[model samples]
Target: MKKVILLSMVTLAMISCNKETQAVEKVKTAYIDTSKLLEENNEAKDIEEKYKVKSEEMGRELRAEASRFQNEAASFQQNAMAKGQAWAQAKGAELQKREQELGMKQQAMLQTLQQESGKEMDSLVKRIKDYVKDYGKKNGYDYIYGTGDAATVLYAKEAYDITTTISKELNDKYKGSEKKEEAPKEEAKK
Candidate 1:
């Protein structure tokens, strides 16, 4: 009778252990391709387009200023012989000063662009991280890893890739948020 009870208890213990193992195995894990997420992400694209336009505008402004300076330089060169050494030297010095000022302005504009872009990119990263955190919470995922060229995760099953799923969700959410922003402006215009 003791042998029978011992066997039953061992069987029960084995079954319970198996159940616990299955429970542990059920932990949800997935990964997103960070590069793909950034590339395909609508918010990221919008930010890029905005910067592209701003860069173009700045380029045009710089070009116009350069053209004006070039015309002055050409005029100075043409009249340098007639204007005498003193006049030519003074004009050259003025042109050099103007060139230096323009160079400084260009540097300032570029620095401003870089600083703004860095801050914006940082904000975008935070936003993405927050979105991912919310997504993990909502989906009951134990882990949602990020992978890319700078891969945090080396290997994961293709079946466990949530890149497409989460990217679509993020884009959809961005679109909805964009509409809300536009609605306020439209109402304000009224």
Candidate 2:
């Protein structure tokens, strides 16, 4: 009879502890629109502008090079009739080699630009992800979902949407960095 009573008490204690644990367990969830964050991110805009300028510069260089090649070809064609067949053939071969080289150079330039842009974008994503992870950890969020047109999160309460909060935080951080960057320049101008 004592053994039965002890077993009942132990069971009751275990159930109470479980109930307390359940009461303490809270799942905090939030969601952010990743596309909106990227759009509002000043650093991303600056990077985009830098790449755009670079691409335009590259395009101009390529166009100039192509124009030079076309001029050379026109001159070669004009001189070929008077220069004789062998000389013309040799010149044609040289022009072909030059054209091939130009093609390869253009390809290389495009690939390099693509690589640089990709690296910058990847770095930006990593930075954002790190920031988000830290934000989640600091804010005690159990899960922070990302939603956009792609919509990783299909439905969530408006109160649980933290996109504006995070976007403001990131923008403020970016603005602070920009101010810090300008401070040195301002001091130098002094």
Report the number of the highest-TM-score candidate: 1
Query: Which residue pairs clash within candidate 2?
Result: none
TM-score for candidate 1, residues paired by index: 0.85
lDDT of 1 at 33: 98
Q: Output the worst ten-in-a-row residue range by lDDT, candidate 2.
A: 20-29
Off by over 4 Å in 1: 1-24
lDDT of 2 by residue, 73-96 (tens): 999999999999999999999999
- lDDT tens digits, residue span 1-190, model 1: 9999999999999999999999999999999999999999998898888888888899899989999999999999999999899999999999999999999989988888888888888898899999999999998999999999889998899999999998999899999999999999999999
**Model-by-model lDDT, in order?**
0.93, 0.92
Considering summed lDDT, which 10 consecutive residues are worst modelled in model 1?
Answer: 112-121
In model 1, residue pairs whose N, Cα or C atoms come closer than 3 Å (at least 3 residues apart or on different chains), thus clashing, are none
Among these predictions, the greatest lDDT belongs to: 1
Show model 2 residue runs off by greater than 4 Å. 1-25, 149-151
